[model samples]
Target chain A: MKKTLYPVLSVITILAFGFLVMYMLYGSGETPIFIIMAIFAIILGAAILALVWPRFSGTSTVTPGQSPFLVSRGVYFLMVIVLLVSFLLEGFNSSSPWSFLYPSENPFVPILSIAIIVGLYLVLYLRKSVREKYSFVELWTMKANDEREQHIIDDAARKTYGFMRMLVVIMGLGFFAFQLLGMSFPAFSVGYILFLFIFVAHAYFMFLLRKITD
Target chain B: MEKTANRLRELRKVRGQTQEEMAKDLGVTRQTVISIEKGEYIPSTTLALKIARLLKKPVEDIFWLE
Candidate 1:
C-alpha cells in the first residue's frame, strides 16, 4: 500500500471514534443524526490531515512519534496543529455566521489562524527553503556503484537531524523568553509558555535521545 | 584493510545489476548501496540476508570476518 494510505486510515479511524464519541456523549435520542455529523466531521478532519501529514512525516524512513499513540516529534506537529485549531475554532462564526467553523471563539480564531499559518510556513521552509542534497533513508537503503552518495545521504540525514535539533532549541529559547515576560505580551505569554514546554520536551528527544537520528 | 564481504560487487555485476537497481529492489535508495560498497555503514542482518538471497548465495558465502 502507498504510504499515504496510513494517514487516510488515521483520518477514518478518527472519524469513527468521533462518531462513537458523539453517540455516547449525546445518548441515543438523536444518536443517528449526531453520528452522521460526527462522520462528516471526521471526513473533513481526515482530508486536512491527509493533505498535511504526508508533507511533514511521510517520505520519512524513520517511524516517528513512537507508534503514533498520542504523538512523537514527527507526529507532534500534527497534534499541535490540531490542538491549536481546536482551540481557535472552539466557538466562532463560520464563513457564514449561521455556519459555525469548528466551534472556536472570538479570541482563539485569530490566534489559531496565525499559529496554523506560521506552522504552515515553517513546514514549507523545511521542505523547500532548507535544501539538502540527500535524504537519510537513501544512505542506508539505496544501492550505489559508487559509495560517495551513500555517505552523503547519511551525512545529510545527520545534518537534517541536527538542524531540526537547532530549530527546537531556538523555538525553546524564544518560548522561554516569552514565558518569562509574556505577562506584558498579552496571550503571548500563554502561547509562548505552551510553545516552550513543547519545544523543550521535543528538543530533549530530538537531541539527547537522538530520537530522530534513525 | 581488506574488505570483509567477498563478492557483493561481483555478484551484483554478474547479475547485470546496477547499484540503483539493487537499491530500488531494497525499497531504500541508490546511495545506500554505495555506502555498503565503501563499508561506511554495515548492512543490517536483514539486508545482508536479502542481498545474499538475491545473489543466490548464502549469507556466509558473502560475508566473513576479516
Candidate 2:
C-alpha cells in the first residue's frame, strides 16, 4: 500500500519544491493561484511522505553517535533556510536583494510559505529511516546523551555559545559605532544578522558534536 | 590511558561473540560496540558495568587505565 504512495508523494514533493522556488524567483502581481495549488500539493505530499517513508527504507545499521545522519539532515535544513530568507526578504519589502523576484504585498504569501516549511518538517520528522539513522527520537527526548555523548555536547555548546556571544557583542558595538558616525544600520538588519549568527552557531555545534563524539 | 586501552575486542572474540551480539546484549548500537573495541569511545559507567556483567568479566578485566 505504502510503496505505491511513496513514489507519488516523492514526485509531488520535488515538483512542488521546484515550483515554489520558481515562484519565489519570478512570481509577480498577486500570489498566483497555481503557486497556491503548488503549496497545497507540497502539504499533501509531505504528509503522505511522512506516513509511508519509514517502512520501505532500510533500518540503519550504523552505530549511534558515530553516523553522519545529522549532517545529512542538515541538507534539508539548508533548504529551509533558503526558503525562509527568501520569504522574509520578500515580506519585509525593505529593498531586499530578492525583492524584484516577488514584489507584491500579500500577507498570505509568507503564511503559505511557512506552511510549506511545516510540511517539510513533518516529512523529515516522521520518516522511520531518518528517525532510526539520527537517533531522532532519542536525542530530542534526551535519552541519547550517555556520558560520552553528553561530554561532547557540553564541549560543543560551550565553544559555540562563547563564539556566538563574542560575535554578537562585536557586531552590536560596531552597529553602535556606525550610529555614532551618522551611518545607521536598520534594526531589522541587526535582528537578521543576529538570527544568522545563532543559526550558524547551531550548525557549527551540531557538526562539532558529531565529530568529537565519534 | 583510561579512554585509549580496552580488552573489549579480545574478550568478545574469546567469548565467540560478534560486535552486533555484544551490542544487542548491552542495549547499544553495534557501532558503539565497535567504537569501544577500537578505543575511539569510552562507555559510561552504567554501560561499562552492563558490558562487564554480560561478558562475565570484571570491569577491570575489560577496561583499565594505562
Candidate 3:
C-alpha cells in the first residue's frame, strides 16, 4: 500500500507542477491565484519528495555537519549578498534589476524573474555532483538523518523561533509607533522588513546548527 | 538534581569498537556517540538501552547519577 501510494503521489505532483508551469507561462489573468497555486504545488512536491526519495534511493544517512548542497559556504554567502543587493536596488529604483530584460511595467515581472532565478538554482542544485553527494530528500527538506542531526535541528529551530518572536513584536511596535506619530510607513519598507526577517532567521539557524555540530 | 554521566567512551574502547562502528551498530551518527561520550547529550531510555546492548553491559553499569 505504501509503495503504490508513493508512486501515485509522485506522478500526481509532477503532473500538477507541469500543468501549473504551462498555465503560468501561457494563461492570462488571475495572476494572484496562479502565484498561490505555484507556491502550494512547490511545497507539496517538496514534502512528498522528501519523504519518498530517501526510502527508494537507499541513502538514509547524511554526514551530521555537512551542508545539504554541493555548493561551498562561499557560494552560499555570495548568493545571499546578491539577493540583498538586488532587493536594495529594487527598492531604490522602484523596479527590479531584471526589469530591463522584460521591458514591461507589469507588476508580475519581478515575480517572474524571481521564479526564473529559483528555477535556475534548482537546476544547478540537481546537477550530477550534488546528486551523487546528497540524497534528493536531504537536499529538498534538509531533514535530519540521525539523532545528532535532529538535535542540532531542534536546537537551531528553538533559537530561531525565539528570535523571530522577538523580532515580530518589535516590528509591530515600530509600526504602531509610526502610526501614532502620524507617519505613513513606506510600502517598500514592508518588503525590506520581510526580506531581512527571513534572511536573518535562516542565517541564525545555520549559525547555531554549525556551532552546535562543530 | 544529580547530573547523569556515562562511561561510554571507556566501555566502547574496552569492547574494541571504534566510534564509527558503534554508531553503525546502534543505527546512529558517530557524532551522537561522541556527544554521549562527552556528556554533552543524554540518550533517551530506548537509545540508552540500545547503547548498553551494543556494549554488552547493563544500562546502570554504563550510566550513573553523578
Which 10 consecutive residues of model 1 chain A have the lowest summed lDDT? A62-71
Name the candidate, 1 or 3, with the larger DockQ value: 3
Alpha-carbon local distance difference test for all models: 0.46, 0.54, 0.56
- For model 3, the docking class works out as acceptable
In model 3, what lDDT does residue B59 have?
Answer: 99
Best by lDDT: 3
For each candidate in turn, the interface RMSD (Å) is 9.0, 3.4, 1.9
**lDDT score at residue A109, model 1, on the 0-100 scale:** 52
Q: Identify the runs in model 3 with alpha carbons over 4 angstroms from their true place.
A: A1-140, A186-188
- On residues A34-111, what C-alpha lDDT tens digit does candidate 1 reach at each position? 566567556655654554355334553333211221123233454356444534453244442212223233556545
Query: Which CAPRI quality tier does the interface of model 1 achieve?
Result: incorrect
User: Any runs in candidate 2 off by more than 4 Å, and if so which?
Assistant: A1-90, A94-132, A135-147, A186-188, A212-214, B1-4
Estimate the overall C-alpha local distance difference test score of candidate 1: 0.46
**Per-model TM-score on C-alpha atoms:** 0.36, 0.49, 0.54
Judged by DockQ cut-offs, the docking class of candidate 2 is incorrect
Which of the two, 1 or 3, has more lDDT? Answer: 3
TM-score of 1: 0.36
